[model samples]
Target: MKAVLAIVLCAFSAVGCGTRTSSEMKNIYKEDQDGVRRRDAKAEEMRYALSFGGCTYSLIAQNYAITAAHCSEESGALGTSGAAMAAGQKEAKDVQLDSLIESGLGSDYKIYKIKWTSKKYMKAQHIWTKFALKKSAVKLSIKPAKGDAVSTVGFPYDGEGQAIVSTGFLKKVSNYIVDPYSEIEGSGLYFNAGITGGNSGGPLFRASDETLLGLTVSGDTPSYYSPNRPESSWSADENDVWNIATPIWVVHEKSQAFRSIVQGGTP
Candidate 1:
């Protein structure tokens, strides 16, 4: 009976030989309008997985993008900012910023300052550094409710250059105590969504409405499976893992500084 059970488990398992191919696995992850699934076509477009440093970021406005400050090199945000001004490049090389702010989350959580005048100016300014300027941005959710379904998009290390998505519940909404060394302000949200090293700065979204909830900063590592180990021996407590995010309202509060960029008032 034990052998039979093992065979049954192996047949149902996603990994291993003779299991579903990558294409088949993709089909199983199809996103539906009902929002039960986390992946969304629109959400994917808003997210830009940064390659310079391991981090994910999203466009909040035509010209503005936000990310975890730690993702920027400890030396400084300009550590990677050295691309010569060029025209017609699909991506801006060595993209620098007009302004970069900590956004009250210490010097590590940075908000890239962009003033978009025209496509020509955006290129001249090297606005496409990490990702080309997306046409639109994600709709920010000022206040997210506890227990709300949530999803996150990131460029996890396993995904190589591809963006990966994970869904879970909003476990809590509380103040994020900032480290004295970091020096930050404001409350943040806590969720059970999966996050990895490269997921830092990724956007979390309310699954039902697809509105932006917050940006992923950190999470507890979950367990993994080994081929030599039996299925019954696999030990992982999904319930225990939780992730932290900086709320969108905090970003909104600081919008006064970049209002003209998003409002089309000035570049």
Candidate 2:
């Protein structure tokens, strides 16, 4: 199962993302009339998987993408939904980001602070850093208004009808009933949306100017594989559609901390 999934993922990475031109890469992920999905300046903010346990991440800053470190570490596997390919199929020389970073060989890592590399995820297995490009910080230092409309940009299966930018409203912002840092396997952001596999680590964005609200961490707004009969609270026909995300404020907080460590300021 793992091996086959890996191959499928490889095929996807090669076909969809590999062929994307610089312009297309910037534009392909936008919203349709339904307002179900969201968009940043770029498209499909995170690289995503098409199956369960799949995780996604996005390029939040220059070279750094904000994601649950645990999500990044856990779903960071190269297993495809997937193809039997590695995180990045091409040799390092073929990738523009890595090459540019190395071209300035003698320079410090901070020189190309905004560049990204697939190897960041490849280095960790059992994790799917499915690349979704989000344009927000990862943490929520500032509180959000409850009624604000939010957007999500992910590779959700078109079957559920929400493609790319899935739209939803911020219902609340209270002390979470459960601790967010509980465990790597269970830590995930929840919200209201008909999201799917490829949506992992996707960005939860704001409606206007597409400011980022959070990152899609995980959840089955409606689970179909359960064994219970359709007589329970969750009937087979009536699915639970909602949205969950790692607040962008959280992402920014982490980034500021890292930036401070590297560049040294009150980031």
Candidate 3:
């Protein structure tokens, strides 16, 4: 599998170290708060965004959370595993994964169970419960159409673990084949939302009602060209680059376990 540039922070540079300095990252988030573009996500929005194993996840149920399938061990996206922490929390909690259900590499959605074990888990659970009391776990929406307004909420690597929100309109919807020789296909929701490393697996929501729409998958690299070419033939505009996401509907269609959990049944 090609290393997911959107999930590995070190991939931004050649030597495996991040390209942005800590101070620069902080400043970038600060400037993004102006609302013209991606900004610091609000408290309510951050409530659903969870930083898990270097990726982002959102609770679909009290015990079940959703993220990009590539982040899972079965997918070999990142291969590294770590504890999970809710936004605003200082310490990350070690929650046992009761199960890690994936639709497949093509679809890219992972729904996992958080075992109610550690004190950290209890703490995070309390927060989720309180939040859910007001607004139930984000409801899934019908397949979105082109020009539909959307927003992505996640912990971008440059945000220093703070949840950031980027708003944009859907550009297109199509099937993305991960392997041409196999039947594996992904339902791709393309948009221009600003996303980067550590944003993988975060929730993409309908801008109007905040319903679940998709999961952040990857974004266009800054430059690309044929190896034979001396100069870059194409370069992505940093201000207006397209990003890929996995529509939530794909998970609903492909994973019976996910459907069962979402419908209030055991997986």
Candidate 4:
């Protein structure tokens, strides 16, 4: 497959990650390329599955959770007509999608802040939430070199509250465009793994050990440009494969800045 998998940033929204897949489509019961279905009993993997705002996230820090910036209303899904807030769902003023997200993550979770958000594209928010978990959060570290094996752990298709896992090799470290308009964000690490909707903000970890590599943020599939209509750019076909992530180093670099902002200091 030589298709360009465009960044499926947030899966829930209309323009998000696209359709949800069944276990039959991807066979969650069986192992994926160099990856296996995480047993429900895996404590570490289970600790990483976080449900909130119609998406899944990784518990990156004890009090901090990382998710795609589009997970919030900034993605145009929080409009008055947006389905983000269900009927009868109510919160205090200014607590729209953020409030819904906080509630979805559980009463223990709250909106800590956001980072790497684009005012133009409004897609790479890197939504951060604060909460406590029974286990320690994954530590953010340097990005893995190309060819390094990595695995994704999160609630695929919501996985009935279970965390699903997939493995692939680190393809490269680069930037991924969200759309043809030319908007972009943080450095993205591409992996060979295939992630369906509901896997956004999941952890991309080193397979040999559980060390964190990055966070799975988006997947993309590109449409072939037709020659009859010559306005299209004839880029190499990406085969509609490959997944992308915002490297953990971005978060690691901003952790102190985020903390400072929360503490009433300049970030």
Q: Which candidate is the best by lDDT?
A: 3
- Clashes (backbone N, CA, C under 3 Å), per candidate, total 2, 58, 0, 16
lDDT of 1 by residue, 102-178 (tens): 45433224666544323443332212222111212333222332366778776555444345677766655555444
TM-score of each: 0.55, 0.44, 0.67, 0.53
lDDT at residue 182 of model 3 (Cα atoms): 62
Ranked candidates (lDDT, high to low): 3, 1, 4, 2
Model 3 agreement with the true structure over 215-250: per-residue lDDT tens digits: 888762332212353222322222224577777766
Candidate 4 local lDDT, 103-195, one digit each (tens) = 111101122332211232222212223321111233222233236666776655535434556665666666655332334334666676655
RMSD of 3: 7.4
Candidate 4: worst-modelled 10 consecutive residues by lDDT? 79-88
Predictions in order: lDDT: 0.45, 0.34, 0.55, 0.43
Instruction: Write down the worst ten-residue block by lDDT for model 2.
Output: 102-111
Comparison by TM-score, 1 against 3, better one: 3
Residue clash pairs of candidate 3: none
Best by TM-score: 3
lDDT per residue, candidate 2, 68-148, as tens digits? 222322212222211112333212211112211111111101111222233444222222222222322222222222345
lDDT (Cα) of model 4 = 0.43
